[model samples]
Target: MARGDGLVAARHLVHYGYKPSVYYPKQGKNELYERLKTQLTNLNVPFVPDFTEALKSADLLVDAIFGFSFQKPLREPFPSIISQMEETRLPVLSVDAPSSWDIQEGPPKEGPGAKFMPGALISLTAPKPCVKWYRGQHFVGGRFLTRSIADKYNIDVPDYPGVDQFIEVGVDADEKL
Candidate 1:
């Protein structure tokens, strides 16, 4: 997901009465950074380079830094960034799997104080095998659904079940078949 799009998404959520914040490290110039800045400006969502400040100001923090391809020990910037995020102590909502986590086997078994641990994980498309195999106690919610972008294209999407509750789908119809 584009950083800009994430900002827009946050703005939309807030517009509809939800409190969300974007968190990222203060890395130097990059294409992603430029795009994110532009998008944040367009959406009019406040952002802070410091994770501590962002966390203090937000009720829910969305982690959109890394995708599902991460499969290694978190290095300097990421580890430092994740460390700051963890210190925030707010409920985290990761975009895909938690950063620095192994998507295939789940997060590494380093110890209780690992950087990949998140409060909540929002899986896109399909739920990663690790999510089920590794019992993430911090996991509070998830969405394993897909959406159609066009007539010919369908993409796996993360679940964003809002605060409202309802029963829209029936489960017994297919059992009769």
Candidate 2:
């Protein structure tokens, strides 16, 4: 809950008229995070202590616990947290990648990281390799990606429609409802 992605998501929720009750178990040491936390605090967003309590009252959960940098074999609190999230069967819109999911392998075939599948995923720059295994609504956002950078990386960024900040992209036909 101390990640920048989570912090930014919280900030946007406030901007968009959503009242987010953050479950920040550990406070971040970074100044950017502190500032974001302070900003959210100033806006009267409640930082709730109990994760289950927060989930019970939540309409939707935005999981930003981990991103592309995540490694295998999740540690304490996280596994429990993810398990709790799965138990709720709540609709989750994971930012970047689902927490504990392998960037290449996607969710594991079994065990700790397998059961939880986000209803939707918002890929930051471009979709990751794990997206191949993801069977849900997908969106891409990165207006800041320069042309040269895209060309250099051979990233096939779709042409955005109008001035939209984000665009929904089609997943595999089999994945469609």
Candidate 3:
């Protein structure tokens, strides 16, 4: 998940009266995981490594590990962990598309081979291209709405535009834009 979206979702869930926990892979030396941990901590949300003990403790699980940026099959521990969640029949709420499913073409498989579709999926920014192609059985009644972090949290996101503004206007747009 994008750091911004994850934070906004964590905050929104808390504001709506739900205690949310953010789970990510903590094994190996992953700097990304550390950054995400800091972000979740800043939001005052709980963070746990992907483990059965953590999954078992949640009243609801929010699958935010794979968001719009995922383009390849999810590897290792994540896929294995997701399979475990499927077996438990826990109520899951995904942040965007379910892990392993292509956001543009629906899940890679169907029927018994199909992966778990969360009880609900909170689509951030906009509806993913796959949402329309996937059968209702995959998504069920599982869909929620969200806004971009800039819109939801009123934060300024930085990007290459800052450079363009500096070149064209001879001033730093990072502060103003």
Which of the numbered candidates is closest to the native, going by highest lDDT?
2
TM-score: which candidate is best? 2
Writing each residue's lDDT as its tens digit, candidate 2 over 1-177 gives: 437888888888889998887888767588988998898899898888889778888898888887787877777778888888667777888888888788877887776668877899988878887887777899988686888998898777777889987889865423321
lDDT of each: 0.53, 0.80, 0.55
Query: What TM-score against the true fold does each predicted structure earn?
Result: 0.60, 0.91, 0.60
Candidate 3's residue-wise lDDT over 15-90, tens digit each? 7888887654633355765565576678788766546877667776666666666666567765677677567677
Name the weakest run of 10 consecutive residues (lDDT summed) in model 1: 168-177
lDDT over C-alpha atoms for residue 158 of model 1 = 28
Q: lDDT (0-100) at residue 121 of candidate 1? A: 62
Cα misplacement distance, residue 160 of candidate 3 (Å): 31
lDDT of 1 by residue, 1-177 (tens): 224335545766767877555554534476766775666667666566666555555666676666575647676567766666556677766655666566676556663226456666644443455565333422322232323442244332323368522212211212210
Name the weakest run of 10 consecutive residues (lDDT summed) in model 3.
165-174
Where model 1 places Cα greater than 4 Å from the true spot, the runs are 1-5, 26-36, 111-116, 133-177
